[model samples]
Target: MTKPNILHESPSQTAGPYVHIGCAPNFVGIQMYGGKDLASNMLDPETSGERITLTGTITDGDGKLVLDGLVEIWQADANGVYPSAADTSGTADPHFTGFGRCPTNLDTGIYQFQTIKPGQTKMRDGRAQAPHITMWIVARGINIGLQTRVYFPDESANATDPLLQSVPEDRRHTLIAHKLDDQTYQFNIVLQGDEETVFLDI
Candidate 1:
């Protein structure tokens, strides 16, 4: 009997130019979904927490701005509760979605998010994690979305965070955001090079 030829799996492809058209139509002026983009607003008036603004630029291996990148963030609420069915710690803020998404500005290549500073959340093993936001990024040339964490500077809890501790001491700095003011933070993401931000596999 002749041996059968095996088909190899198809290689992953980049996000492509149409990413914004489908993921954030309002951004590209497509005016879909009632003219509003999902995750554009993470909170309402009744949301509880210290409102904060996260702004940054995404740069490539050559230090060039990634003008078409899209960023998404997921985090727990102010009281360390997540708005998910799997979370049994406590009820999360009903007015806060705990998730957000934004595309880099075409003109300036900057992305920003207005949300609350999350509180420390417990890990599956019951250890407390530092207050941080889980960030995911995708762009024209990215075959797969990049995942990372945005840890706040000067948080004492960071010293004991299990995930943070797992990262190399020197590279751990890449995970921290710079505080610009009381409510503003800057967290630049470098796709590659000497200052490349550390990305998580998951």
Candidate 2:
């Protein structure tokens, strides 16, 4: 599918990393369903991966220049289905909008998002449960994209998840996230190398 155009913004110097433990905000917890105070699954998170003008810069450990980073992500619907392809009552689910975009942030890293976490599917091996969510990532200098599945750490099902199992034990910690507060989340991403994340080839 052709990529979508995203609203552009100059990289803000204000964005900071969640490096200091306890320095991150106390994120509000979100239930998977649309209930009382929760945001409906209508928020869009999409951006570009190739062009620095499209994606933003990525900051290093010292909050330095990490450029040309492209990121792409896919997620299931609120009902979790490769959400973009979902239809409802022959009309389409108005509440369920499947979206994807690659937008660069002030830090020079491309940001991409699609609505809904994919429903848990068994890995080819057929041995575990799978959790899902909107995946966000920053890559190295626009040549390749990094892949990491954002998962809720509190989910009881994560323990039995098959895809989680596919990840090496030492690296599994990167997949889990703590609820910092409502609307925003706080999680640290580990890039590959001496301090690398398990990035996907595609």
Best by lDDT: 1
Against the true structure, candidate 1 reaches a TM-score of: 0.93
Which pairs of residues collide in model 1? none
Estimate every model's Cα lDDT from 0 to 1.
0.94, 0.43
Q: Indicate the worst ten consecutive residues by lDDT in candidate 2.
A: 47-56
> Model 1, 151-198: lDDT tens per residue?
999999999999999999889999999999999999999999989999
Model 2 RMSD vs true structure: 13.4
Q: Ten consecutive residues with minimal summed lDDT in candidate 1? A: 1-10
- Compose the digit string of candidate 2's lDDT tens values, residues 104-188: 3425343333243435544446554565544444433333335566666577778888667778898887666555443233344
What is the TM-score of each predicted model, taking all chains together?
A: 0.93, 0.52
* Model 2, global lDDT: 0.43
Output the number of the TM-score-best candidate: 1
